[model samples]
Target: MPDFLLSQLLVSVTLIIECGAMQLKNKNYILAALSVSCFFNGFHYLLLEQPTAGYIFLFSSIRFLISIKWKFQWISAASLCVSLIITVSTYIGILSIIGFFATIFITIGSFSKNDRFLRLMMITGGSVWLLHNLLLWTPVGILVEVIFVGSSCIGYYRYYVAHKPSEP
Candidate 1:
């Protein structure tokens, strides 16, 4: 198969996995699903010759899995540091910087104990990722980020907004 075709396939699979992950109620389950999605997404970026984005996604897969077991601030800090290293080492351009910040938001959110905050961070990261995908001109990636952000917003509203006590 052509590299473009395969890249699209991988990102499509990532889209499916991420969409499902957004609906998950448990943090561990969400991280598990995101880990798989990030692996596929990493390959998708590599196939497209975006090494910086590719490595970041690959590292994110591991980070998400580790976060499931250890939701510590230090772990989150370490993940950010590693992401920075990956970005600097594989620096492509401004996109690398954008990808780094996006990863930072997602990494911090992943390590948090609050589910609502996680959803919010996912939305924020997804927005930044959307820009990166748009610039890359990856149709599936752009679609996935749009859906990811939308789903996160819906999840946030469903779980947090709906459950909030009414104002007196």
Candidate 2:
């Protein structure tokens, strides 16, 4: 299989299945899909010498359903920590580390109510984009990447701070 095929299939299947199950009472499927997708994506990336940031995004989502839950927080923290380490490794010239950490952190922050994580994401994103520029010797990709990261970070902030809770 192609390196990305498994992860791509997992994500597509997840989107399809989840959308079909929107009215069901059991939400375990959503969590399970996310977890499995993250696990596969992360594991695949690791196998292919890629950053495990996709795992961070999917695995760290328990914080959304509840606040400070044990499994969710620990997993999120672990993924976040891994992502950060990957970020550091990326800067240090790890050829395999593809800055997935920044992407995953932003994904997680975008899903949560945590402004702190959002800010952390923006900083991490900007920092990594700058590092990419430093390494690539080109400014072309930097603007697009920075804007993407910035936009996602800002969207999360705006949503969390400006929106009313649907319930609870």
Candidate 3:
């Protein structure tokens, strides 16, 4: 199969997996699903020749899985530091900056115990990634980010907003 075709296939799988994560109310399950999605997305970016995004996505897969079992502040700090190192080492151009910031937001959110905050950070990171995808002209990537943001928002609303106690 052609690289482009394979890249599309990878990202499409990522999109499906990530979309499933949005509906998950359990933090650990969400993290697990995201880890799988990130793994696939890493390969997709690599095939597109975007090393910065690719490496960050690959690292994120491990980070998300680790966060599911450990919510230590040190872990979050180390993840951020490692993300910076990856971004710097794989520096492609201005686009890499976007992926780095997205990774930072995602890493912090992933380490938190609050599911609402996690979804919020996912939305923020996904929005930033939207720009990166646009710049790269990856239609599947752009679609994934858009769906990620929308699904995250819906999840947030369903769990946080809709269920909030009525202040009397």
Q: Of the pair 2 and 3, which is ahead by TM-score?
A: 3
Candidate 1 least-lDDT 10 residues: 159-168
Q: Tell me the deviation in Å of residue 156 in model 1.
A: 0.6
Worst-scoring 10-residue span by lDDT in model 3: 159-168
Candidate 3: which stretches are off by over 4 Å?
165-168
How should the candidates be ordered by lDDT, best one leading?
1, 3, 2
Q: What is the model-wide C-alpha lDDT for candidate 3?
A: 0.91
Whose lDDT is higher: candidate 2's or candidate 3's? 3
Cα lDDT tens digits, model 2, 1-168, are: 874555455444433433332222233443343344334434533433334333333344443333223335555566566656646654434322545545555445434444445445644654664454345433333443454445445544554456653531
Off by over 4 Å in 1: 165-168
Predicted candidate 3 versus true structure: per-residue lDDT over 15-55, tens digit per residue? 99977788987889999999999999999999999999999
Compared to the true structure, candidate 2 yields what TM-score? 0.37
